[model samples]
Target: MSNQLDLFHVQRAYSLAQGPLSNDQLYQSVAEAAGLASDALNQRCEIGRAKAKRSPLKRKIRWYQQTLKAMGVLRKVEGRRGVWELAEPTDKGLHQAPGRVCLLAYSTRLGVAIWGDNNAVFSHLDEPIHLCVTSPPYPLRIQRRYGNVAEHEWVDFITQSLEPIVKQLAPGGSVVLNVSNDIFEVKKPSRSLYIERMVLALHDRLGLSLMDRWPWVNLSKPPGPTHWACVNRQQLCVGWEPVFWFTNDPLKVRSDNRRVLEPHTDRHRRLLEQGGDTRVTHYGDGAHRLRGNGFDTPTDGRIPKNVMIKGHRCSDSLRARAAAKRLGLPAHPAMFPTALAEFAIRFLTREGDLVVDLFSGVNKTGMAAERHGRRWIASEIILQYIKTQAELFSQFEGFWLNPALAVDSPDRTGS
Candidate 1:
């Protein structure tokens, strides 16, 4: 239960190996030292019968690994299984005097892909794109200069935009579209049904299949619908949106669910150690549902629920906002959480894979793509948005990037 020596143990294991360890070797060694099965070491046992919860030890190891990796203490690589090795330290210049160093200046070789129009960008990209993750402007009561279509025209607009995009997908690639329903009509409290309509349109008209849907929740968000939510308290505040995953072939999409596994709670560890649920219970979604045998405490970690809880990084974005103001630019009003892009990227694409964003406002997708070692090309119509985003990226150097250059808009005259 104590995390007193997890780092020490992990570091010692790596020290003994003196080289990268495959997931099997590293996990088995750790488990043997701890007097547990290799798979059990990764198990998250439940703590109680009544409440459904699990342990965090297995998850803690991963968290520590990630933290150490982030701090340059270790490195993790992807392949048949994870490959991890102790990393040598190099000066990141963090301690250097202010304004003396900038990371982006050194990482510019990775190349930055920027375009002003989606159609033009797609036409320009002949290479296959492994994934397309974007949070396009949605139908709303007031038009944002960033270009949201009217409610009635939204589906057609999206269908037309995606026609070229889907063609660029590499075999088994995916598209994750982040969208929310519009509540413009006060009487239609349940929302304007635009989101559902769009999903149907994507399938019926565009030949895209709805693979999965994630409910993205923002806990500390602004209240919605002044009439029903704030004043009357007749409806709960709107706090979630849907991120729809689509692919041409639902049966075969480039997905590695293991990458997005979540940490289990304290209770799950207990159950995992026992190698069985506290009591026999069936998990749903198929006929082969059994609770005791291979069904408990999977070593791959627990699949995250369909609900995604992510908050906008307010502090980080606020700094960007101030910088935008100083530069005489407006911060994007409807930017999705960075994790939205990150989740889709890790879930669907591998390292060095290409990800394209058709409506990449402010380069949130660009930032996430860079973090995951994935190549990225993003298109945004607004020049100021691209300029401000490029300015922000110019300060950091965790990933390789070329300077973002502007391209003449192919449809510059359209709304």
Candidate 2:
């Protein structure tokens, strides 16, 4: 058989084996999947006059299996003779080879979920990323079940996490980071300046330029910081978080505001119909000027402001949480709204571009990218979270779970 056909048979063998399979079973599974006749599959190869002949197809399968193992795709079962299985996750990353990432799951033609540490996975990325968007764990006063660094160590932690990833970004790619604004100093009322430090660190370390600072106002957020805001009367309720946008090259940043435009409000529509203001208007002692026909022309939609007024209780997160509950799994602690991810994705990238999220909680970026016809790659350390994300993504049209990574059944862990 040709090398390409041999490779196809080998891949089929790997995919068909759900658990540890013996050599004979693997060969039979591959033969069945590829519709190969037993005679063709069992063709013998001559070695020496005194030795027994071996099947060439089986030898090729073994060779390809070793190659896949070198690429971190398969593993040999310990204490079991001639048995093999798909590689499992380890604390250091996937267990086979160094500098190779394992795919946890993937859609038919849209995206993939990488199973491992973000830093380890980022270092092995071979393709350029167009958009890198994520809401990493917040640097809180108290740590949550999902890992988060201390307030004082946040800048360093984030810098280390993003440096390698940014190095693989396309020339004009953008990185949108959502950071909490409620992180306060230890035993003090003053807030930490980690966001500002992060901006400067990325700029100095990764040569990225700050594009804009968008404030995401969660309208449905309840009052928090109870001690300072409600009891001490020292701080006001913080209902907004800062989202920083950075680019590899400021002059050529890949962005189009028109893609994320919102529908015109009633007042704005009326103003357009009325042919704008009749008289020239000036504010701040003529410093700001408004022309009479400025609003006369109609448009498809209005350009959105930097202040995004979105509710925290988005339907996507709600539905995902309910699904987790139904499956007897713990709900994700912090799931950013899919709308927010969609806004950034549409504004920053065109269809078919690659969007990446290293700290994916529920893989919202993947969902948003899939909805908009963009390719995506999401990496998360926690197995349960990635499994939950896979369940949600399976509902997408044309979704295809990677058979090689589906052997290990999911165990309920804190989300």
Candidate 3:
């Protein structure tokens, strides 16, 4: 097959140098074309096959040839056989210099690559991303500082800077913003209401529709003192972070399958254990069996509700520091758990779909995409962070490493 293809290319090149040929001329003059037995060609092309492989290479070649013919690169007459011809080079940007960043695509393996800055990413993407999951830096003066921009400034960044990238997204693509309200102890008022209003402003101003809110319930302790001594001491602060899901086109955003499942609660379990009493007779045998066993059987996999528990913390904490030392990389502050990213990716995208994260903090989303066998593009603003993340990622052969690091490794504990 290789030899045949080589001969075909050689013959075609030579024929083009000479002149275009008729069907008979092509078949007679071209070495491989002349050598290709009609019966064999028909069999290889699957012209007479009852059942053909879906998206076969031979069919792809035929389609390519047809497209070339349509574009006047090949000569094909109605009721006549097709003849190949070289396409004339156009003086358009087709001959212009290629972009700096180039992506090498694959069919099987997930595409994982990191871009350092916004400039590096905007022009290099081959396919528009279907889903983008990110949590941008809040207005809080935290461990690290990207900028000290005010609320209005951040809103402008979303509308002016990020909106362009959002426009590049596919018609049905979605953006999930996992931002939290800023708590200013000095002010003594929650900034959540202001942030929520800003989010609404962005949606309305940018023409993006709000799909839903995913509440991230934080089980961690709150900082600073409260008015009441008891309230301050035993404050079971139920911190809820808002995750706003937005879409450029609502119709295009389909349900994601990776939505979190509600585990059976203790009350539900107790009811199931007792089953229905003599007064209450279960209709279905399966229902009765489930009730008798004290287990709540799951219904269909539906879209996940707004509220979600903070199953794992982001990469910046002490836990992440330990994991990073064990894994041999610098800990990232904004890394979302792979589980969360996986859930969102599974629900929002099909197999082989592209996922993009503009604020690629720690590359968690990219790692998740790789684990789930989906392609992803990640862009981080900070160069140091990009280098750190790349080095960390390069250590692993796959998405996750084996023998997961202990929560309290000595090196991590020291940090």
Q: Could you say which candidate leads in lDDT?
A: 2
- lDDT (10s digit) by residue, model 1, range 16-80: 67778775576566555445544565556665566555445555556555644654556775563
- Residue 245 of model 3: what lDDT? 79
* TM-scores of the models, in the order given: 0.65, 0.74, 0.55
TM-score ranking of the models: 2, 1, 3
Worst-scoring 10-residue span by lDDT in model 1 = 93-102
User: Whose TM-score is greatest here?
Assistant: 2
Candidate models: Cα lDDT each: 0.66, 0.77, 0.53
Task: Please count the clashing residue pairs in each candidate, in the order shown.
Answer: 22, 0, 4
Which portions of model 1 show Cα errors greater than 4 Å? 1-111, 186-190, 232-234, 278-298, 314-316, 396-415
lDDT of 2 by residue, 1-415 (tens): 4122333355446555557878888778776765678776678878558567887767766776665575565678899988887665333221222244545555647888876678887887899899999998888866656667887788888888888779888888999999998887777778888888888999998888999999999867778788789888899888888899999998888899999888999998898889866668889989878777677778989898888788887888987887667544568888889999999999999999999999987899999999999999888866557656876887677777554333222332222
